[model samples]
Target chain A: MSVSHPPGVHEPGILVLEVPGDLAAIEGVVDHVVEHCAPARLDRRRLLFNFRVGLTEAISNAILYGNAGDPDRRVLLELRAVPGEVRVRVSDQGGGFDPESVPDPRLPENLTLPDGRGVFLMRELMDEVRFNRAGNTVTLILREPGPAGAKIPEAVISTLEDFRTQLGLTLVAWTLAGERRVRVFPGGKVGGADAPEDPRPGSDAHGIAGTRRFRVPVGAGLAVEVEVAGHAAESPVARVLAAAVERSASLAREANRNRAALEAALEANRHIRLDMARERLSREMELAHDLQMKLLPPIPRLARVDAAARVVPAKSVGGDFYQVIQLSGGRVGVMIGDVSGHGFPAALIMALVMSAAAIYAEQGAAPAKVLEYVDRAIGDELESTEMYLSLCYCMLSPGFPDIAYANAGHPHAFVIGAGGEHRRLPATDPPMGIGAAPYGQSRIRWKPGEDLLLLFTDGLSDTLARTRRMSGEQQVLKTVEENRQRPSGEILGRLFELCDRATPSIPSDDRTAIVLRTR
Target chain B: MSFNMRRFGEVTLIEVAGQLIVGNRQELKRMILAEVEAGTRRFVVDFALTGYIDSSGLGILVSLSKKIREVGGRLRLASLNEDLRTLFELTKLDTLFEICSSREEALAE
Candidate 1:
């Protein structure tokens, strides 16, 4: 089976045999044909099972059924063994029969009758089965299941076919695996021609009698051999075809390696893109958290008032803020706000509100007027981002009997008396984004030098709700009542200490509280 | 193709190896039918080592199932690989046979 030739010599690729039409010859003929097909390099299992069984079935049918057991008749077996496929044709001398008339053996009723399964087995095992119109000649084709690394792409095959035709070659073949050759003909047909010599020497035939062969090494353990009509072994056309085959083979090998490398690179790029996106999001949140913390104004020193405010930022940046501004005419303005959402958007809104409140409150405007000015400054920003803030502003003056205040849906603002009694300054309007301009103003009775004004956001209370038996606001008020006689800074410290001791069940929000007293 | 046969209580278990095709399906049919004739009421065909089966192999299994059912016997198949299981599902034969995931489960049934 190892038929090796000199570099430029022609080698036969077809085998034809004739056997007597007898069932006894079926096994010997099938084995002989299979041995001739070794150059195709099919896998061992497929060669031993599928090809052997399919060829045996075809030969047996040609002998027993096609010839009707006639000893004088002959059956011709023509085998073509190429690089990737093997084709075998079995033709008998007897009259043909219709292949469609065979019953399907898989049917339940036909399952018990085992004689009708030959055609089914042949069709199942072989890659392709074709019958001539007369039905006497049946060709079975078996293909090699090439591994992915050894497969030549379709574009390279077509390119080589173009070069073969242009060079007036009768045949061009390349060794694939072992002695198996991938043959390409002049008209783009592969493995169809059994003869390479041209008898007619005309314009189309290129005035040649026999084929002149040239071989060139293309890759590792691979060579391309081309056959042209007449004695053109050293002609310019032979050299051109040799160079083209060498160039195309190298390009094909490079393309296969590049395609695999490109796929791996694309897979790695996908993971890196996802990781970078997550990293960018966390970095932006940290920057927003820094900006929100730095935007809060410090409590100013005053001759008639003691004020302290504290804010604990959550893991995710939130928009809870407090401001204490000393106004003209010896009055102090205290403001606290909680934005509706958390993140950079809410932090931006909080910054804008604090800046606007400070600008208007320092001008000695009333509590309602300051809120109206702040709302006008940031109303469109809140509406566009679909967020709002709960704000409470109170004005405290020396020797005043009551505190003038404006509450916009701020529920935690209260005036606590020295005797542990508390009064809530309820909402005068809805929150900023939902409430219209000209915000309502009100006054709560205040005992100067005897009352403490406490304001905190919902985040402070929600953190304490998990560990306290009573409501979170009631716990805060009781702690404040117990420490009412201490300095404002100490009272604020105790409130935060109580919150830090309680365990939280959920993600915490920004906690802010302000304690102010006018003496 | 080859198979191993064992008796677990009243059940006869046959483990088929390699490919069960037209070349060796008759041996499997004969082995199962002979056991049924000997008054064996239960059988389990384990396919843990079998890789492939063709149409003729499927045909022989159907005929054996019919014969075993006439004798009031039960036939169960177990441990089919993914490709074999899909083949049975595509042929709509999964419903006709009681299939189990493991050989022990088939023997327990």
Candidate 2:
């Protein structure tokens, strides 16, 4: 079949080949592409290298997988060439498999699998890889890249070459391409990128002691040594030559120093930006911390239930917040939460959750519904910030024997019995902002005058003690077990006291806890 | 902080010096990302000359590793000092990267 041409093919157009679905066709395609690509150019050489491998893999898959080893099948491979880039498309006639269903090759179990690594390699090697909805056609893009010091101009070096030609100099030596040292005569020729071609005449090992050479600092880790014949360092012509070379080198050195100084200034500016961001965050956190502290509802005076909560941040602000809201129909709602991170952002989130939860929980909303509302409200922010919060909110009403609660990844919620037997209020959903799974509500048996409900944040349980060890959740449970018979607020107070005594060092985090009991 | 780069076959060996802290994390990130954009697929970050690293530096490495992996490149680390070694272990990031004790091991085929 004849090669086809597509619209927008620039002069010296793209390459199209219709090759039979045979493995033998690979060598022919590689050779044809190499011939058409400009291998002499430095940037294009890099592009060619990447294209060779990516195209090989893509065409191999198209032939083997798409054609299913049928020699009669034809694979359509199209290569579109642009300035400093190449786009290739490979299509075949076959049913497609879901790319998503492909197992991760990095997993230990899949590591031994040989057949599935082709697509992974292609995606990794190429700059861009995309597939059509049908999944049979794959398009890949590759770009050219110049080396680190490619920005230095050729005009700057031509002046030295002109001076050398005028003086009948021996050779000019300089570092080129940020990789290799090059020596060139007054002879006019551009050095290739790969390596210095046509080495300058009489360029053998010459020590700098004997040669009347002028050392020129080219900066960016480069230096040029200009040596002349038939001239002493003190000669009038040689003196003039050395002055010119030194002046140029000094100018280049100044330029190089300015560049380094500019980079350093940029670095300093970045640090200043970072410091400013941090300072602004801390300042805002202090304000939000104060506001959130004020937003905390004082323990409600209820005839049927008694509740008390306290939150203390290790820094000026923290992620821990609590809500004690009086709901309609003689019901009482208690909530405690810990955002994933601390300081300004977490404090802001806590403040938002505090205000939103207060409004929703006081409207007699169900525990699950209140959590769902909060999740929806904060889901975008949580997703953007890549953080999540743990929450345990419960509703207790008069004559209702069970307390309905929704636990969103909160670990430290419990109901302690009069005999010091405590039961964990199980987590009913993945943490808010983690999963789309609906908030689940579960009820536990609640008894008046016989049971106490307790909730605490991880900062309390995770506090480091004198042992340089974490004061674990087990410690909190033990503390509550020791003081299960005490009133709700007194239990909280003693818990704080125990935390203070266990202070092996400074508390590195915020601590918040809530306790509730029926009168 | 400063970086020096050398090439061996498909891998670009980077020699990092000074402390990799918040002060220079962005510069480190830019250099690495520039290479990735330039089609360098394999990198070995040699930390033998490095003195210290904080959480910000660690965070930058993680981000760089993720971006490189997303583009089908691999980044290996070599010769971490005691402080860096402990920081990686403490943060459980030792599991996420391929860290070697010597340049030979990092460049192994």
Best by TM-score: 2
Tens digits of per-residue lDDT, candidate 2, A1-519, equal: 113333354445266555444353353455465555552233544344445556666776776677776543456666766555567777666665566676655565543333454565566556557665556667776643222223223544566676767766654444432223454433344333543433543233333455565555443334455566676545576567556655665676577657765655565454454344334434554576687678676887988787778987664455788888888887889999988664455666887788788889988889999898888788887765555789889999888788999999998899988888889999999888776447899999999778899899877877623333435677787778898887778888988887777674445567899989886
Residues A1-519, model 1: lDDT tens digits: 001122353444466555544343344445566777777877756676668767777776777788887644556666888876888877777788888998776566664553566676677667667766567878887776323123343444565667656755455443343324544343233333442433332221322334566666655444545565653757887777767767777787688668656754664564355345334545666787889889997788998898999999877677899999989889899999998766666788899999999999999899999999999999998775556899999998877889899999998999999899999999999999889789999999998888999999998888888786988899899999999999999999999988888843323578999998888
How far out, in Å, is residue A487 in model 1? Answer: 0.5
Model 2 chain A scores worst on lDDT over the 10 consecutive residues at A144-153
TM-score of each: 0.42, 0.48
Give me the candidate number with maximum DockQ: 1
| Model 2 misplaced stretches (Cα beyond 4 Å) | A1-285, A464-471, A504-506, B1-109
Q: Residue A466 deviation, candidate 1, in Å?
A: 1.3
- What are the lDDT scores of the predictions, listed in order? 0.74, 0.67
Q: In candidate 2, residue B2 scores what lDDT?
A: 72
